[model samples]
Target: MNQSSSQSSNRSLPDSEYYRAFLDRDSNYDGIFFAGVRSTGIFCRPTCSARKPKLENCEFFATAQDALLAGYRPCKRCHPTDHPGSTSPLIKELITLVESDLTRRWKDQDLRARGIDPTTARRQFKSRFGMTFVAYARARRMGEGLKTIRSGERVIDAQIDSGYESGSGFRDAFSKMMGSPPSGNVAHTLKAEWIDTPLGPMIALADESALHLLEFVDRPGLETEILRLRQKHGLAILPGRTPITELLESELASYFRGQLQEFTTPLHLYGSDFQKSVLKILQQIPYGETWTYAQQSEALGNPKAIRAVARANGMNQIPILIPCHRVIGSDGKLTGYSGGLARKEWLLDLEKRRKS
Candidate 1:
């Protein structure tokens, strides 16, 4: 199966695609990839069949041995460590050192000081995890921050415990996931997390009020949208979870599984009244059905607002749930979408297939 080389980090499965497979426990991908759950600190084959972990808690590795090398223990049920290759003694020792000093930032020079070839370590880690060892270590540190916060520790305490000396760095990192400032006493703040999908990874932001944003990783102007939402709503977006996040994750998994046709997750919309009206028109777009910009404009009682309708569609931060992709050109040609035209096509095709 020449699995090792082919499954290198660059050639690894896309997070979104692999996440769908993992959710389904697809046996075809069993030997091709392993999933590491940050919350449990365990790795499992794709077909593990255990209760699926939250999307934010997952990291993918190309091999079971790599999972072990990255400091995750193999799942007892999946027996990922029982796979073909054995972890080299050197790699095992390296992993041990990494786990022991997870709070300390690691550098290639540190490996060299220990008589290990820095290039070898970098290549091995990159091949397996699609990132350099230093990157993996930093992610581990961030994971620690998540744990501290999840355990009910205050944000400031978690920042120090996660080895951050600067308050701004900790706040920035934490806000991007948790969607609330370390000192925020704000209520109903949406927590944002990334989930891998077949097209690519998508970000989901939610709070007790409603699901706020769901945009693809490659969506154009995504950062702009995030910033605007944060500033306008005074919400801090970080990498944590809430009850709504769990609900959205489950609904999204079912959406991909073809078991869910519509989303019932509550949503917190942010925009001008006109934009809200435009989004409302978009939401009325039925499953497997599409509307043209002109059609939408007329429906909104402003037939002359065709261009405005199109602009609103482009500005939509929420994609599938709002059904922005269902708005096409008057000529029935697919038009501009923040998630890209190709995704628009795929979403339409998926709806069509499921409709039959």
Candidate 2:
């Protein structure tokens, strides 16, 4: 493949065109190029709300790495390193508020009291997290209560700490979330944490030791995937972080920064033996490399199982770590990716750029 063409495609538009988009704060231009402000020595997405730099002071680059290589730091306000157009300011604010008070029962009235429109909050949260803001807060509260109960606190105290006034109410909510009533003796729990990346926001589900699932938050059927994981493992998945998740988050940060190539975070594969073998092969795919489905199938010692290999690739739960995005069509074109083809392209571009 012509690597020069690939680089050119990423920045096909002329500088004048990019400058116009930068001036307009066009969301469409986001991730297409980053604008580095010469005066401020910072790079930002086209949709960055920070005051625009003068035309003479602006320089454009195809990727965040390019901007950094040009000696420009990322803009703190716009977070150009994050996935362009994936998160909104409101979502960030609400997440911060929820984190600040995990035990707070957030009602629609409470949202209004905080000068946030409840409907907007619900819409934005649903769009970003596949759940409404209220649901997200409730899950957080339940997680906090679970942590308290696991620490040997009385059930009543746990309920009160979760802002539930009545034991029955707490039990009902807990049962709905956990598939059963909580108990102090409960041994296994899965924690879910949201991870932001240059491609998008991803949801990570893990226990104390190993990561179980990781997928882009906007991936189709993500909620169903979480439910299936809960049912399959018979574990209550809560909105919290575990040691594995913390490690994965740090690894992802480094990965996106082009400082890490191999992911060493432990993972627990939940699939049939055949599917597990397929995923293992995906990991063996070298960084900054591409493989056809036929190649993967052959690597699995089943040359005729190309279609089966593709099916297993589709079922992969972990993306970048498993490197499913590295698999392409025999025709040398991109194929299906759970995170969307655009993200798939971005990841490939990022790897290739870093490798070069």
Candidate 3:
């Protein structure tokens, strides 16, 4: 049974064939098998767009455990094992059924007719997706509705397109989620765009020169942030992207690869003056090096302000671009990071490997 399971869920390939796939770095093979490169001694999914290694310089493993057993670890992007566990056959069937009919919302009565327990199904789905099935379905339908409106369709056209018949019902939902009516306007004139990142999705807004907002998909207080932007600018942000989006994506990829030593692109910094000073000091720490809070405070010419430095570091608005991760605790521990300490360690290690 163990052997059969491995073969059925084979996420990796043999060393010889794995090298070929690794050389390609194609998205088609991602999440199947984890590939470990002998050259860098790093394991990654096939879709990792980072620079490919030579055929002979790569190794492969079927599972993350196998990779780690052979002295490799998990890759960040693709989040190989980050998904929820496989559901029961019935839940799988329910998911498949709902997926087939995206135009129509699945209701509890529909599940009862199929002899499925709606409450149990709801719990299982929420356990995996962090939201109830109905919530996700509603979000999906709303996304479709938004797309239709963006394409110059009438409000009623968009509502019907999303499987909703009542315009008022749709209007209430839109206002609750996005804080405005159906129009996805931004700046009364400025543009906004959505780009997928390794961590999650980012909704970025920019002008001709600088990127103003780059919020993560699951950022705490994200809804509050959006409302703040709307009230301050007298406009609404829609899901969209501009030409500079491509530049930001490329540079972020490079930064992940340790190829980028600094972010030269214009950044519209937002934060208190103390936070700004701390962030600037963080940038000067250089790639692959680090500083403690006490060290950072000393550099700021206020040796007694170590706690203030730490607090300021916590509020650094721009993460990777500002390089607040280069600041650790005086105890040499990887300290607080808004993006999580694991990511902080990962970035620091990535930079160190590049210096090597």
- Candidate achieving the largest lDDT: 2
Per-residue accuracy of model 2 over 209-299 as CA lDDT, tens digit each: 9998898654656656766777776667655678888899889889989889999999999789999999999999999999999999999
> Tens-digit lDDT track for model 3 on 284-344?
8988899888888999988999988888887665677778889887779999887668778
lDDT of 3 at 108: 93
Q: Give the runs in model 1 whose Cα sits over 4 Å from its true position.
A: 1-164, 167-188
TM-score of each: 0.56, 0.54, 0.55
lDDT of 3 at 117: 82
TM-score of 2: 0.54
Pick out the ten consecutive residues of candidate 2 with the lowest summed lDDT: 1-10
* All models, RMSD in angstroms: 10.3, 12.8, 12.3
Clashing pairs in 2: none
Cand. 1 Cα-lDDT: 0.67
Ranking by lDDT: 2, 1, 3
Local distance difference test scores for all models: 0.67, 0.72, 0.59
